[model samples]
Target: MTGNTHIVGGIAASLAYAQFTNHDPIIMLAAGVVGALLPDICHTGSKIGRKLPLLAKLVNKLFGHRTFTHSLLFLVMMAAILNAFMPFEAVTAGILVGMVSHYLLDMATKNGIKLLFPIKLTVRLPITTKTGSKVETIVFSALTLLSFYFGYEAFRFYL
Candidate 1:
């Protein structure tokens, strides 16, 4: 999926969190957006990767794309790291949820992610598509609509 699609997925996750939690929506939304793009930082060609070229190149050379960062191990390690350093439970939840959403979105593609790394198990959805294909374009459009609706619902009062 494209970064734009991942971003919409993040928005959807954040909006869902906002619907249930009493945590600050603004913070959650920001974390969601950032987290969605974080996993792809392994690929230098990726959106966040382009911004942080050195880190992205290092990661790409060290582990290659979609290996460590896209794994469940990474998620657990991230949660632990955030728990130790961030200390903001709600924002942590938002970031994790956003990253999970990114993984699931990637699962919908032909190049499925190794959700469990070092085990060589590539988890994938039965229904899949080529990345950046027509299917992704449609999914992106639909997710965009969902984001707009959720955004309006979540922020309408302030608007």
Candidate 2:
């Protein structure tokens, strides 16, 4: 999925998470956006990768794309890291939602991610679509609409 789609997914995930918790919606959304793009740091051509070339290149060299960062282990490690530093449970949950949303979206692709990494267990949806294709466009659009709807719902107090 493109960065924009990931962003939409992140926003939707954050909003959904907030519905069950009292965390500040804006902060959760920000963290969610970060989490959404965090997986792509392993790809040198990704949105975050372009901003941090050295780190991206090193990650690409060490783990390759859709392998390590996309793994469940990596997600667990991220949760641990956030738990250690972040005081808010809701914040941590928001971040995890974003990361999980990214993985779910990636699962819709043909190559799919190695969810278990070294274990090489690939998990994907039965049907998949090519990245940046018409199908992806449809997915993006739908996710975008969902994001907007959820965003409004979450921030209705402020609006």
Q: 70-129 in candidate 2: lDDT tens per residue?
A: 999999999999899989877788789899999999999998999999887778899999
Which residue ranges in model 1 land beyond 4 Å of their true spot? none
Task: Quote the lDDT for 47 in model 1.
Answer: 92
| Pairs in clash, predicted candidate 1 | none
Alpha-carbon RMSD to native, per candidate? 1.2, 1.1
- Candidates in order have lDDT scores of 0.88, 0.89
The candidate that wins on TM-score is 2
How many pairs collide in each candidate, listed in order?
0, 0
Mind sharing the TM-score for model 2?
0.95
In angstroms, give how far residue 153 of model 1 lies from its true place.
Answer: 2.2
User: Model 2: residues >4 Å from true position, as ranges?
Assistant: none
